[model samples]
Target: MDSTKCQDHEPSTKLLNPEGPTATIRPIDFTRSPLADDYSSFFAMTIDNLLTPDECARLQAAAGDNWQTLSKGNAFRECQNILVFSPEWASALYDRIVGHLPEEVKALRKGDRLAEIVVGPSHLKASVGARKTVWRIKEANDRLSFLRYQPGHHFKPHCDALYARPGKDERSFLTCQIYLNDAPLSADGKSDGGETRFWTSQVGKRQKPPAMECEPAEEKEAPFLDIKPKMGRALVFQQRMLWHSGQEVKRGEKFTVRLDLMFERHFEKLQPNS
Candidate 1:
């Protein structure tokens, strides 16, 4: 058993198709938003119709039942997922969003640009890997994790974890989650509960998910923002200090693809002709 098999689901050699993004940006600026941030939050954004319902459906179909249960053990993420190495998909998705990102994001990609961002629980240093600053954004890393949350499946409230290749001077700083199917509402336009929720309340600032998988806690007092699952929608956020969860899928199955932003550490911002 190597990095390829023996899992509940095997990784896909070829992946899904990403179309030209055709959506406007909805910026989530923690610094200005009423959303309480123990520390000033960096920029997070969401886009509607980044691809299309048809495109999303095709991708999901292509991944048809190839998912392996990733919820084994006490995993915070309870879903069936498959790993995809799709540089083309990554590139297409990045092209759609890169032009719309805040200039700071592009600058950060140039490396050594953003000042240390000590926000949330994960403090940042003058570095660009796990536990580093997320004030920057770059092209998408070529790995995509396709996730499927059937009824009762969910992800616990926790910060996104960062990763890097063994020796690459690059690391992931942002998470781009693309929802495939719409978690439809009731007949009368009433709401059901499948949402990716962002918890803004300042609580035990644990950087990692629980050591073991456990049941969700009873309802408590904490403010949270719910991003409903709409087909073709893409949610981009910093994987730094923000605490979030995939609210339990009480009804329908929710399909999503998790992509990432890779920050280059060996690069630098070139000054204009000086």
Candidate 2:
């Protein structure tokens, strides 16, 4: 990442999934913010301002209008409703961040230590076998899931499902959650509650990662991390071994888009559920 090279116009590259045109201009000062720390790259990282505040506002407006197609209303995928959409900007956004990503995240690693830690123990390996390797990032997933969390909406810890199709050279390996607004806090400013928290599960554990019925107050022991939900920040992480949940919203409305990063899988004849 050379920060100096950023300019008015950027080289254009084609998108994979839908074969669309690439982004011609950089949206924001992506260079001003770098990865928070080294460990941020291991499983998850909080990327600052991937979407400009204006862009986030526009997307939120769109989500509000198209609420009928919402997904998830259960305890596991709890939320007001997930508004799904496939906007034209999806490709452009993916284009700008592709270069900023570290080489390790740009490619899928079936043997990645992190992936093995979660997948091997969970029933996920039955579907996400180690045989399929990473070819390269294909494009942003076609669908963008916009989730609005109100007063008490939340989700329990669980690993995201793998959408893999090795025969077609398609697989989803990473998730890029774009925060549209800052999560609110209490009047006393003590708890910044609506955060997405991560937890670690050993590789030998059973398929179902620890699913708590409610926030464990006694387990007030800090989690692996509570990723910052700063407005316009994008928290990107690998799908494998990442057990996370959306903590209950304490104050105002919290908005986020759950977007997946599609990857071209190395050809393997025995690929499972895709």
Candidate 3:
């Protein structure tokens, strides 16, 4: 392997299974955020202020009127209720905001040549399993969901499920989220804890546990990353590679919009010359 090339020796299976060894969280500045770089081996990154305050407010109002309680098995029980946007609504939002992305972010979204070079051929080959390939962006924008959390609400630690459907050939490979509002402050002017927490360790098949129930005895002493909600900030990550949770909202309401980026797989079939 070339030292200049970005690569990870760990098997991709560990990313999907989540029973593997812990991986430390590495933070990167949004201005120099990795698009098609070696940093992708970790599969997660944050981009600050991806949305304008006006956009966040507009979406939040729409979600407020449409909120619905999320069911137990559908989402982790600890997650609060949510409002899902119609496909039309989501697509419009994607169109409006995608142009503001950095050149690398745009390339990654389109899966362009630079993205392929940075992420490596093996990563792409393993993901779609085609000898010859063409990558296209398939947005799950229509499936965008808005989540709200009040005091004590939280989403437990878990890895996202691999996107697979019995009849569909496409799959979701990435997760994206935009924070709509700052974590609300308490009476004393302290922020309520509505941070998204990422753990160094993965959650195995021992039955998914609630965030409160599964927390380490000395949370302050544990190795983890906590990202506080900030208005307009966005986060993107390889869905299957990270074990994460929404920490409890300690004082006031927290709001966010979630979207997934999918890829449609296509392979060329060889034809015999007549």
Candidate 4:
């Protein structure tokens, strides 16, 4: 696909911030299957030029002043920093997202179908002679986080927390990530290995998912999905079900913005497992 054409076609709207510079949202012209039969109607979509290069650079610069090392349980190896946008900016962006959502998605939200709402359609139809699918954004976390991954930095394979605990009212359903810049090039003139890797199980109904190491495997029997970070690209997927990780950076640096799309689900009986 022509990056120039995609960039030119992006709709200029007051979605992200009405007062500040406008943000664009464009559909990705790619094909990716849903995770399972149950989620066949649901869509996982990636959009390009969601944030312009200038916007990404500004966010990256803001994060530089306050880079915080992230931890996984007790390990402080996973590194990142949280970015807090102004209240006006946040509210405007959220409202713009709500405005762009398709009617079907709005109906699901109105019905309080938390499960279906979490994995709603993408709303983007396939190109000629291609399969058809729909995509949409049901919700997003109040805050956005900026992460910087330098050489050798990586996040191990793990599923995101399903629920945000009782009384929190917020339950994590999907993860949305936007790349600030392209993957750094190496001495060989090739992009470094900082792709996000997703793992799936071969055996049916296993008690737990298989474990993934800090580094990428040369080969694996189970199904896997690898996504390369590119400037202005955004990826959204099921956070609780997909086992994924941020691969180790081989050179330069990788920056991204991570946001969780959540909903309020009140459990009648909160069990330990629930």
Candidate 5:
């Protein structure tokens, strides 16, 4: 038998859409948000209309094989890191491109068969990608997505980056989270739980630290954006600069997808010029 014929696996040659153009995340000019006060949390913001109900349903259906329970041992004691179980819908979405690429990337792309369930023509009109404000950090060192699962079973506290292994620029950039399911605990009419909390840190502590030891804060309040986990709603921010956490699931189970991006050293200038 020919070796090519005998082989069941083949290499993929799909050229990804060129890491679109450079995108800038800015603060609302009208309102004074803490997020606007400092550039540390600059890479972060929330986007609505990323997905629709139909698309969420499709993702839930696809998210089966990728589903895993969030273990307590792996849960973040100080920062918000926890393994989450993908919902049936999200599991379905995970299955769509298991081999094509990383599950998180597929989840973020808007044209997958599963994604079209809720993706409307206008969905991308004002989106981060469409606006070309978020230029994919194409450096070889750019950070990719990390698939995570958080059941209604867990919660994490306010802290900065952790769980990221060694790689240039990985820890130095921003973090964006896309909600896969509307958690019941999520209020504010956005979605449910699986909230992304933004916290306030104490003075004289401007360095990033490991996510274990409890760090005392001068004071803290509800997240600047207590995001509800709505499918396609992306929460963006600087992972290391923002003292944020995954709020506990109180009502129903939640499903979420996470991705972290590291920008070029000088691109931080594109950040809010605080």
Candidate 6:
């Protein structure tokens, strides 16, 4: 046998599971879990606001300022977000702000330009820390966004990790999901598919082009924790660790606002945690 051309071939050296070593599920109380701990579960907190029917209607009407409905009337999906800087609410919040610079920050318009408007001190202060909170803002950051699920509509099993960019380099530290409306319960006194399911593992993270078929067996039966969406409540979680998806809507609607926080200045500048 020729040494150059007939040399024995080496065995292929590749492990089937890429994350076989450093993957796990750490359990902790969903109600009072610390931010530093890594958790792969869904959690939510009901806010302490009690708005009377009249007040609810007024807020709904005046909500046009920063409020954006997901779909038009009659549509199955409807949601809103960041009313802190909407034009209709702008003037009111402006009056609430000290010195009220109306000329400098007039209308609360959508996009990157509305950052100059400041709503109020209480609104700003409420957003501090990892607590489930909201703030009235003159403008929303680029990463902040909202979503809604209408009657009969559903967001199937999916993961926040899907939002993670390529190269295994960058990831968002926090994902804030807030529920603005509560779905009414049925005759049995149980709400429909308003639960948020967070999967611990078995998601197909294999490299493939977008829209490619995912590994079915691994995703369909993953261990999961379900969280019901309540009005004025919010959930904060580590984006990459949790694979979450919305449950099917059996009766009333579901609305949620999402804020994805990127630690680096821009998406491109993200680096793995040191």
**Tens-place lDDT digits, model 1, residues 204-249:** 5443353222334433776667788888888987776566788878
Q: Which residue pairs overlap in candidate 2's backbone?
A: 164-274
Between the candidate structures 1 and 5, which one is better when assessed by TM-score? 1
User: lDDT per prediction?
Assistant: 0.64, 0.57, 0.55, 0.54, 0.39, 0.39
Put down candidate 3 lDDT per residue, 26-107, tens digits, no spaces: 3443224322232234445566655567657765665545455553543454544454535555565554344444445332
Which candidate's lDDT is highest? 1
TM-score of each: 0.75, 0.67, 0.64, 0.62, 0.49, 0.45
Off by over 4 Å in 2: 1-41, 68-74, 109-133, 165-167, 202-222, 267-274
What is the total number of backbone clashes in candidate 1?
1
The lDDT ranking, best first, is: 1, 2, 3, 4, 5, 6
- Per-residue error for 75 in candidate 3, Å, reads 11
Ordered from best to worst TM-score, the candidate numbers read 1, 2, 3, 4, 5, 6
For candidate 5, write residues 245-270 as lDDT tens digits.
56655566665555444332112122
In candidate 6, list every pair of residues with a backbone clash.
Answer: 65-86, 66-83, 66-86, 70-79
TM-score of 6: 0.45
Using lDDT as the measure, name the better of candidate 1 and candidate 6. Answer: 1
Per-residue lDDT for 1-274 in model 4, tens only? 1011111111224223234334444432223433343333433456566666776666556444556666565442466665654343344344534443344443323223433434322212122233222233435664567788988788866655553535763455566787989988888877687887666522244445322113222334545567789886777665534556787888888988777665543223223342
**Candidate 2 Cα RMSD after full superposition onto the native fold (Å):** 10.8
Instruction: Please give the lDDT score for candidate 5.
Output: 0.39
Answer with 3 or 4, whichever has the higher TM-score.
3
